[model samples]
Target: MNSSLSIRSFAEYVEQFTSLLIDYSPKLISALIILFVGLYAIRIINRLVRKIMIKRELDPTLSKFLADSLLWALRLLLFVSFISKLGIETSSFVAILGAAGLAIGLSLQGSLSNFAGGMLIILFKPFRVGDTIEAQGVIGTVLEIQIFVTKLITGNNQTIFVPNGILSNGVIINYSMQGNRRADLVFSLSYDTNIKTAKDIVMQVMQNHPKVLKNPAPTVAVKSLTDSAIILAINPWAKNADFGAMASDVLENCKEAFDAAGIVTQPYVRESSKA
Candidate 1:
């Protein structure tokens, strides 16, 4: 009788275990199916988003960032849903996630601002890669536009990382947007020198420059008359890319022409009152 009682008790335990499995198996299977299907759907959605961005000619950095962000966000939602299907309390989970997100956001406020600024820049395109821009007192060509910072290669070959937050808020001068730029130069000559003759020589030098634009015509005129010297303003237009070289050439050529023509330049005197 003792052995029979023990065997019956063991059989009852097995029956109860089988009943429990039968009761929960469908739910477990459904949850797993949903998880797999959600993952596949998220991948498809991410791929579609990437294709759309490509079609729109979006920046590659922005496109990849957006795709990954969307993918993870969708996967997180799917995870929450899958947990709920498994009879777990997703409200508490969502609350925990929200609190965590809030904490992270608070801790990274500056970074978030830069991220937002980057988004704005990518959307509006204030300046693009390879464009020469001046911002935050640094002048350089834009090397890359990232989510947090913009990389610039300065004329001195220094690579500078400027925060996008400042870039978006600050004044950005894009020199590459304009097809041409004006080269303004000031030349001083002694008051005793013939102003008309100096102006003619400077104008001739500019006109002969190969890079100088001829349609707008170069201007050489007396800008101001000082006690020590008369200042001549030389204004010439050149292609944006050629502005620097053209200015240097003009300066060198003008100096040589002035020397050849025996034009006397005024010696720079710090104390003009005493002179």
Candidate 2:
């Protein structure tokens, strides 16, 4: 009879514990509902914030990052709220989140740097859209500037995507920013050709061309006498819009004049593959 009574008392104790848990079930249900509602509210708030930023003309990429970060932060807060509702301590939750963010930033330092560089480009208009520039040793026309990368269309019609961080640190040549540019031409002729005659011919060609600017006074002189040729250097300033056509025409004119005079000429080889 004593064994039976002990067993029955143990069973009653377990039953009471279970009933106690069931009685608190309403609190658990309320916590879950609060968590879901909080998350939904945060989502709505994020959308509204993004809309406002767009209306204010905030950069699109930056606005998107802000909205996503806000949403994640809100979800974390909702999680902390749920934990608190469950009668657990939440002081450490916020601290943990802070540490996590710091660790992530450290791990993604490169990406963060690129993001910062992109912001700089957008904030300061070093070169605007449709500018022809040389950057990172590649010469191209800028197509689009994004948060992480900038797109360029090369002279060969190839598409190039460059990270913003390198562009920020590296040397960039902006060729389209000036109103007028000087075309430096070094013409080579056989050492026996008369230097003064070549200069007169070049000057006459410059005068005939309508695109060449006369105010700067097209300069022409013998710069050097190489082993094979005498180099005649010429620098002419012209409106940016005339650079292409005038340069082509100048070379053609020089060839015709030299041929007519029957003056032997040396080939003008490129000293640098690119400038």
Candidate 3:
């Protein structure tokens, strides 16, 4: 009798297990199907988003970031839905996820700030990639604008990564924004030098330069009289790309002209009266 009773109990346990499986098998299958379909949908959506960003001419870094973020968010929601369909309560799960997200966000305050700044930069567009800019005491051409940082290639070819937070908040001087830029140059001359003669020489040099713009007209004037010298200010306008070349040419040509005219630059003096 004892052996018969043990066999009967084992049979009863197997029946119950079979019943449970029968009840859950369909739900499990449905969850699997949802998971696969959801992942495929997320991928399609990500691709579509990337195409749209490209169409809008959005920054490549920002476009990829936004697309990936959307994909992950959609996948997470699909997972929660799948769990719910499997007869699981998702409110508690969502709450736990929310708590975790909050903790992570709090811990990454600086990163979050930079992300926000990057968003602002994309939206407002104070500067764009390939533009020359000065910010945070560094001047360089923008290489890329990422979610948290911006890459710059300096004139010396050094790569610098500046945090977006600082870049967004700091003053940015975009040298490439305007099509043209003015080169401000000063040449010191002896007080006894003929101001008219020096001005004529500088103006002639600037006007004859191919890179200098002729529309606004170059200006050569006495900027200030100092104890040591008379400061002749030469302002010339040129295309943004030609600014450096134009300035260098102006300086070199001005020096040669002064030498040809037998002009002598005054020595440094601290206490002499202005001419």
Off by over 4 Å in 3: 1-29, 56-66, 85-87, 265-275
- Least accurate 10 contiguous residues by lDDT in model 3: 263-272
Candidate 3 per-residue lDDT over residues 1-275, each given as its tens digit: 99999999999999999999999999999999999999998889888889999999987766877887898889889999899989998999889989999999999999999998888888888998889999999999999988899999998999999999988998999999987899889988987789999999998998889999997788999889887889988999999888999999999999999999988754436576899
Candidate 2 displacement at residue 13 in angstroms: 22
lDDT of 1 by residue, 115-177 (tens): 988888888889888889999999999999888899999999999999989889999999988
* Candidate 1 residue runs with Cα over 4 Å from true position: 1-48, 58-69, 78-88, 266-275
Reference-based lDDT, residue 261, model 1: 83
True-vs-predicted CA distance for residue 149, candidate 2, Å: 1.8
Once model 2 is optimally superposed onto the true structure by TM-score, how far is the C-alpha of residue 161 displaced, in angstroms?
Answer: 1.6
The root-mean-square deviation over C-alpha atoms between each candidate and the true structure, in angstroms, is 5.2, 7.8, 4.4
TM-score of each: 0.76, 0.63, 0.82
Write the residue-wise lDDT of candidate 2 on 93-174 in tens digits. Answer: 7688789989999999998888888878777757656777899889888888787888899979999998988887788888
**CA shift at 16, candidate 2, in angstroms?**
18
Q: What is the lDDT of residue 100 in candidate 3?
A: 98
